[model samples]
Target: MGIEIEQKILGHARDAHPHECCGLLLGRGGRIEQIRPAANVHREPATHFEIDPQALLDAHRAARDGGPQVLGYYHSHPTTLPEPSATDRARAAGDGSIWAIVGEGRVTWWRDEKDGFAPLPYALRDG
Candidate 1:
């Protein structure tokens, strides 16, 4: 529910533009520490995303040193809806982390809270 965190997330997602921007959320208990951008690569069009290994490792280390790390992850959906697609569902990683869907212009975010990836009510959140 803060401007600074929201702006960071939006800025990262926006920076990706047409391509999906992948990253990790670091923080603890509603306190987002950082939004570290990772590899946001797709096999092609209408496909799922794959984070680069090197980028992932770096992110993990960043989270370790930064703060409560591995809060969640983010990626843009480009021309698709905010909802998860079949590919997304299939590729879903049940790490109990949040997932952000950045549409062409709009943005939708979800979080894994025990049950599943539920839509998160937009609010001032960290990580």
Candidate 2:
């Protein structure tokens, strides 16, 4: 992940303070190159986050059109630690995609594994 990307994620989190923000990460080979902010359509956005379905669709379509791969998804915790909550685990599909959680002035990455979300180490590239 580039430091710039990480900062953007945090900025989104701050902009949505008191509510959970959500978005998609576009990149390749374990590096995030872009951040796409998606509308949080969850009924209770303060505690839950549901990325707008259309955003997901557009991402896939762009991939088919030679855009960056759907590297992963990102969301904020609002008041909790920058880690996946139980709800996150339940919603995960175990597809081994990256998951970035932003909160508490930090951004953490995880790998959605078949068993669970494993913490992922990342290096920030100068941007």
Candidate 3:
């Protein structure tokens, strides 16, 4: 992932303010190349996020059409800490996908493994 992507995620998180924002990460081999913003269709957008199902489907379809792979997801914590919340833990699928949580202008990366969410180290590259 690039620092530029982190900056974009932080900016989206800030723009979302009290509401959580969600998006899909398009990438390859664990490296994120792009962030596609999606609608947070959760009933309580302030505290939770559910990426719009249609958007998710479209992304998958695009990937089938030779687009970037759907590598992971990103979300924001408007006023809370950057770490994953209890709600996040409960909802995680444990599929070993990357999850980025943005808060306070910073982003924390995690891997949703079978056991739990584990911290992931990543380099911020310049484009």
Clashes (candidate 3)? 0
The 10-residue segment of model 1 with minimum total lDDT is: 40-49
lDDT of 1 by residue, 4-116 (tens): 65576677767776666677766678655566677766676234567777877776786678646677777767667877777767667766677777675665778755555
Candidate 2: worst-modelled 10 consecutive residues by lDDT = 26-35
Off by over 4 Å in 2: none
Q: What is the TM-score of each predicted model, taking all chains together?
A: 0.75, 0.97, 0.97
Roughly what TM-score does model 2 have, to 2 decimal places? Answer: 0.97
Q: Model 1: runs farther than 4 Å from truth?
A: 45-47, 113-116, 125-127
Which lDDT value does model 2 have at 90?
A: 95
Query: How many angstroms is residue 74 displaced in model 1 relative to the true structure, after the best TM-score fit?
Result: 0.2
Off by over 4 Å in 3: none
Give the distance in Å from residue 49's predicted Cα in candidate 2 to where it truly belongs.
0.5
Writing each residue's lDDT as its tens digit, candidate 2 over 1-127 gives 6789989999999999899999999987667899999999999999999999999999999988988889899999999999999999999999989999988999999999999999998889888
lDDT of 3 by residue, 2-108 (tens): 88898888888888878999999899877899999999999999989999999999999999999999989999998888898999999999999999998877899
Candidate of highest lDDT: 2
User: What's model 3's overall lDDT?
Assistant: 0.91
Model 3 RMSD, rounded to 1 decimal: 0.8
